[model samples]
Target: MIETVIVVLHLLVAIGLVGLVLMQQGKGAETGASFGSGASGTVFGSQGSGTFLSRVTAILATTFFLTSLGLAYYASHKASAVQEAGLPDPALQVEQVAPAPVLSEDVPVIEEDVTPVPAGEDVPPAAE
Candidate 1:
């Protein structure tokens, strides 16, 4: 149950990170525009948005990394638990398949027998 929750949270954070990164304007966005037009005069002011967005992105990225590590650890632990409880380790198990049957020389093989005709005489025509 905890693993499931962590996975869901990790996915949400990843999606949010993608959206936030895309929403922020790149440094080169205002190269051709007037300085005034490029200015952000809102609550975040000129430099606040850049710093705030970057900080939030970092936090989300850290969370994503932690969740990934956690999931890996949990999976390994669960597999070990199964082994400790006497259940077979699927990776270590080998299936016993039957061997193929061997052929023997005792069985007789059929062959065609023929006699050559003498070369000088006219050969008799085969009857229909």
Candidate 2:
């Protein structure tokens, strides 16, 4: 339950960061206005330092970073829990492992002979 909440929060923060970054004007944009661009009037009244956007963006960025860390923590903790339960770790499983080779029925199986020869009996010759 907590993991799900963290995941959702992480996604929301990521989207917010993207939107905030896109909405912010580049530094070069302010330079154009300084050259007398027909006496343009901005929302901050010719720029009374609207650091509000910058502060908000910084806060959102910090939240996004924190959410990312939280998600990673939850994932690692879950993986550890699975390991403690004696089940195979899903995160450690590799899908690209090669399988053991299989032999056809035509192939002979070589095994050690376990039967002992009785006393006074002629021992059979070993196979070539």
Candidate 3:
């Protein structure tokens, strides 16, 4: 249950991070405003949006990292629990089947006698 919650939270944080990153304007956008493009009007003022968006992005990134680590930990812990319950580890389990006998070159192979017909010959019907 806890792992499920963490996974959901992790996915949400990842999506949010993507959205937040896409919503932020590129560094080149500032250059346009300086050339009198009248791009100075911003919702979070001149410099405030940068700080706020950066801080939010940082927080989301941290959350994403934490959730990633948490999910990894839980997965490993569950695997170990299964191992502790006397189930063999798949990596260590080896079936002791008998190896196949290697064929030697000394073995004789029988070949069938096949005859080829000429290309322009009138073909005869196959015998029953």
Cα lDDT, all candidates: 0.84, 0.80, 0.86
Best candidate according to TM-score: 3
Ranking by TM-score: 3, 2, 1
Local accuracy of candidate 1 as per-residue lDDT tens digits, 1-128: 99999999989999999999997888886453336564566677656477888999999999989999999999999999998999999888899999998768997878856557899988778767
TM-score: which is higher, 1 or 2?
A: 2
**Cα-based RMSD of candidate 1:** 10.7
Q: Give the top-scoring candidate (lDDT).
A: 3
Please provide, for model 3 over 33-104, each residue's C-alpha lDDT reduced to its tens digit, 9 standing for 90 to 100. 667565457676655367788999999999999999999999899889988998978778898999899888
| Model 2 residue 46 distance off true place after TM-score fit, in angstroms | 2.8
What's the lDDT for residue 68 in model 2? 86
Q: How well does each candidate superpose onto the true structure, as a TM-score?
A: 0.60, 0.62, 0.63
Residue 51 lDDT in candidate 2: 70
List RMSD in Å for every model shown.
10.7, 16.0, 7.6
